[model samples]
Target: MTLAAGSLCLGGIVLFVVLAAGALLAFDEPGTANDGATFDAYVWRVARFTLLQASLSTALSIIFAIPVTRALARQLSFPGRVWVLRLMALPLGLPALVAALGLIGIWGRQGVLNSGLAWLGLAQPVSIYGLSGILIAHVFFNMPLAARLMLGGLERIPGEYWLVGTNLGMRPWSIFRFIEWPAICGLLPGIAGLIFMLCATSFTLVLTLGGGPAASTIEVAIYQALRFDFDPPRAIALSMLQITVTAVLLISIRMLTPKADEGHGSGRMVRRFDGRRGLGRAGDGLVIAIAVVFLVLPLASVVSSGLRSDLTKLVTDPLVQRAFLTSLVIAVVSGLFCVVATAAMIQARQTALASRHPTKPLRGLASGISASTSLVLLVPPVVLGAGWFLLLRPFGDVALFAPLLVILINMLMAMPFVYRVLEPAIATHSARTGRLAASLGLGGWNRLRFIDWPGLRKPFMMALSFACALSLGDLGAVALFGSQDMVTLPWLLYSRMGSYRSTDAAGLALFLGLICLMLTIAGTPAADRNDKRKPDAA
Candidate 1:
């Protein structure tokens, strides 16, 4: 039964992608024949810009992250170090639109940076729009992520390496060369690839900050083709191009990066002898301080600026109220669907593994199911929305099913994350309790209720909260499907920003940020708990 349910969910994802691709292909035939040259030029321009920005963004992020990660690894016991690590996680979960707004508060024409420059007697104020703004935002979002991943790699380095280096009286540079560089190298390809994929497929950040066509990415171009130009054929062409690019990148990343073993550590900090004083300590301190300010300032701006806005009026406004309600409902439904689907998949995989002599096909099926969940990432939300937009247009008004489509797409988007969060907890629970429950004749719902819920509750809630937060902040599908009746908070915030209603947008960004922040904070404890269980599991 579990396998059947899991297969059904996996099949739904496959059908969704196939139908979207089919619709895109079918729609392109007539239009491509006539506008092939125009389409080709336009796609080339967008694709070129997309790769350029993604490459630059990826480069900048990794470059900055190396120094920061090295600093973090060297300065292990600084004041507020724990809080600094926590701050890094903020950008990962923060909404793109909110982060963009916070950045504008710091870098816009009349923003803090410009004011500071003017005070310093500079005549020209720097612009935070176009390519510059996009790169900044991508770095703001991805740099910390790269640093964290690298830090994990650094942390996994055994203490003996550092001890050996200390015994030889190696300088800081030698320590980095012999001890840290090798660990970082192993992770760099995978980390770089992930950041590049994120930047290449970035939708909300690009759409929000991309000032004009010159700076626009393929994802933003796809949005413009559909919404601004009313050109479904162009949208189809762009969608296909993005799908091709994404699939190729995924393949390249897989081929370049070997899968590493998931080894559990003793959770003990490696005491390092280098960077204890003088220039090294000072440099690490400076790097950590800059990183903290860069990340925290925008979030601080969100809160301060938001509080200065007409909060009472914004909250009481009918449209704002409705958008919030709509966002809430959609987020809740999507989260529930994601958790349920992930649970089914996990159950099926566990059942397959539990088999004493599982057939090769059975093992393949289990692996395939896991891969399929992640395959959703290959098809960006905008591509899915565009394909579905074309598929449903013939039937009638697509706006009627906008909420349904958004929920489904968001659920699929959040499934891989939910799977990661819950799979471990569920597996651990089953391993510990399976035999006892079976011996006592427990099965089905009763077994799950009696044996699973107690241990699984925290992880389950964590996954649900994370899924909901992701759905709530999503702007891609809703940007395509949103109409008069189906306004979500992200769509509303984007509209306000476009309309130059900066005050209102600030207020909305604040509210959205707070909610996502709360949900993220709520989910962290479960993740910590899960991490603690890892050593035991190993």
Candidate 2:
């Protein structure tokens, strides 16, 4: 049963791509390619912009993250520090539309900064549109992630390193050169590669702030081809291009990133002797403060601006109500599907490993199942949506299948994250209990209920909540399928923003942020509970 379920999940992804490719092959006109129209210009322009923006975004995010991570590394015990670290996770799950709105609240034409400049008679010198806007939004979302990953690497360094550095009377730069820099250097390729992949495939932020053709990425171009231009050939070509580019990047990342078997450090807290002098502490403070303001101010502005909105009107608004319901149903269904599918895949792998006959074939099948869960990462949502859209257009009304497509797409999209969270726990559990289960003659439902469920419940719940939050915040497929009848919150928020309903958008942004936050928070205590239990077990 587990193997069957896992096969179905893997088959679903393959089916979508196969159907999409079939649609393109069936529908694409040979003459269109020979005619040399938008395809040529779009290929060069969109590809160029996509690479340029993703590269710049990755570089900027990592550059800004280094100083902040260093600062936080040095000043580990400041008041409210832990909360600030928690807040850093916010941008990861925060809806793109919410972040975009929050950004606009502070950086828009008549935003706080502009108004302040006007008061100073200093003609507002900033514009949060075009390439600049895309970069800012990308940085807002990615810098914290980069910082945390780097900080984790820094913290993993042994305390003896700090002692030796101080014994040598090494300056801050010298210490970093010998110790911190080497650690960060090893991590940079992976971190930067992940950031680049994210930015390269970015859809919502680029669409919202792209402003015009000058800043459009390939993902946005694909959307425009299908939605606005209604050109299937162009859309298919762009989708293919996007997939190719993503595949190349994924391959490159696999090659570039170092394996994670470097060092298992002595698990003890390091006493910091460097970066504690007056000027060094002051510098660290400034860096930390800047990072805080950069990360926090936009969120604060969203809340402050949202407060002025009338809640009664927002709740009563027909579009908001419909979109909220649609979003809730999608999130809930997708969350459940993601968790079950992931469990099935993990179970199948465990069963294969336990197989007494034809172990090689069973293990190979299990490996394939494991790989399929991550297959979603290689295909951008826009491309997947476009592929399915092209496939369905011939059958009839695409709107009828919008909800179903969104749910399936969201499920596949969340699988990687879900797998990452659950795989470890499941592996550890199997290692600990596989023999015991076999000796007891436990298998299938009985084994799962008697062993796996109790052991894996916490991580499963946490992964589910997180997957739900991710799906809740997604705008990819909804953007492709949005219409009068089918509306999700991110789509609705985008609509309001596009229609110049700033106040309404801000109010909706607040609501969306709250819901996503609650989903995230619901899972937090589970992690804490699991952590507390770990020490006792150890």
Candidate 3:
């Protein structure tokens, strides 16, 4: 029964993709063929820009991350280290638009930096627009992610290795070469690939700061073709191209990354034996200071700027209230859907594993089901939303289904993360409880309540909360469906930004940030306590 339910959930995902892609192919206008000259040129331009920005963003994120990771790894017991780690998690839940605006608040032409420069009698040193702005935002988010991942790798290094380096009197650089570099090197390719894919598919950052055509990415191009041009054929073509690019990147990431569970660990607190010299400490301090400012100041701007906004006015506005309600409904519904689907998957895999004599076919089926959840990563939300729009257009009003469609997309989007969060916990619980349940002839609800519920409750709730937060902050699918009647919080916040209501946008950003932050906090206790995790990453 559990296997059947899980199979149905997997089938639902497959069915939606098939329907979306088939609809696009079916309804694509033949007229686009004659305009091939213009279309091809446009496609090539955006494609090149996407690759260029993604590659550069990936390189810069990893380059800066190495020093930051080195600093954090060696300086483990600082006064505010735990808070810095917490702040690193902020970007995961922070809406992209919020991050973008916060960045602008500090780095824009009339922003804090420029005002400070004016006071200091100096020229403005930088512009946060076009390619430079996009790069800055990408690095701001991804560098922390890379640093955390690398720091995890560094922490996992055995104490004996560091002790040996210390006894040999190895310098920081030499110790890094012999001890840290290998671990970092092993993770870098996967890190770079993930960052590259993120930048290539970035929509909110590109949409807000892309300045002009020269900076547009494939995602923004898809949005334009769908919303601005109303060109189904071009949109379909762009989506296909986007999928192709993402598929290649996903495959490359798989190949480059170590097959073992290489990330998302609550790393053990370990002592380091090196990098204690005054010069070394100074270098580490400098890198740590720069990274903190780069990441924290934008967020600080969000809080400070948001505090100045009339919160009562922004929150009480009818449109803002309606959008908030809509976003809440969608997030709750999507979170429920993801949790149910993920539970089904866990049950099915556990069933397979607990069988007395596991067969080849059963093993293959379980593996395939697990892999299917992650397949959503290859289809960016922009491409998926655009494809679905093409599917629904022939049926009359797509806006009528906008909320429902967004809910479904959000479920799919959150599945991979949900699986990542829950899988290890579920596996550990099942292994510990399986024999007892079987001995008592317990099954289904009895087994779940008596055996699984107590052990798995924290991770389950954590996964649900984070999944909801992810849905709350999403802009990609919502961008495709947003209308006056269909406004979500993200969509509403974006509308405010578009209309030059920066104060209102900041307020909305703060409200949205608080909601997501609460959800993330609700989940953290469980994650922190689950140190016995065995990686079952999807």
Per-prediction backbone clash count:
0, 0, 0
Give the CA lDDT, 0 to 100, for residue 33 in model 2. Answer: 57
Q: TM-scores across all candidates?
A: 0.95, 0.94, 0.93
Model 1 RMSD in angstroms: 2.9
Per-residue lDDT for 220-278 in model 2, tens only?
99899889988777777777788888888888888998876445557555789777779
Which 10-residue window in model 1 sums to the lowest lDDT? 529-538
Residue 333 of model 1 has an lDDT of: 98
Q: Tell me model 3's lDDT, rounded to 2 decimals.
A: 0.84
**N/CA/C clash count, model 2:** 0
Task: Write one digit per residue (lDDT tens) for candidate 3, span 1-538.
Answer: 9878977887888888777777766764656655445358878999999999999998999999999989888986667777777677679778888899899999898789878988898875668889999999999889889888888888778776766677898887898898889889988888888889889989999999888888999889989988988877778778888888999998898888875444343454355766676888888888888888888899899999899999999878998889889999999999999999988987787777667888987787688778878767878788778878977777899899999999999999999989988888888887787788889999878878878888888888888998899899999889999997799988888888889988898899889888888888887663345566422110
Using TM-score as the measure, the top candidate is 1
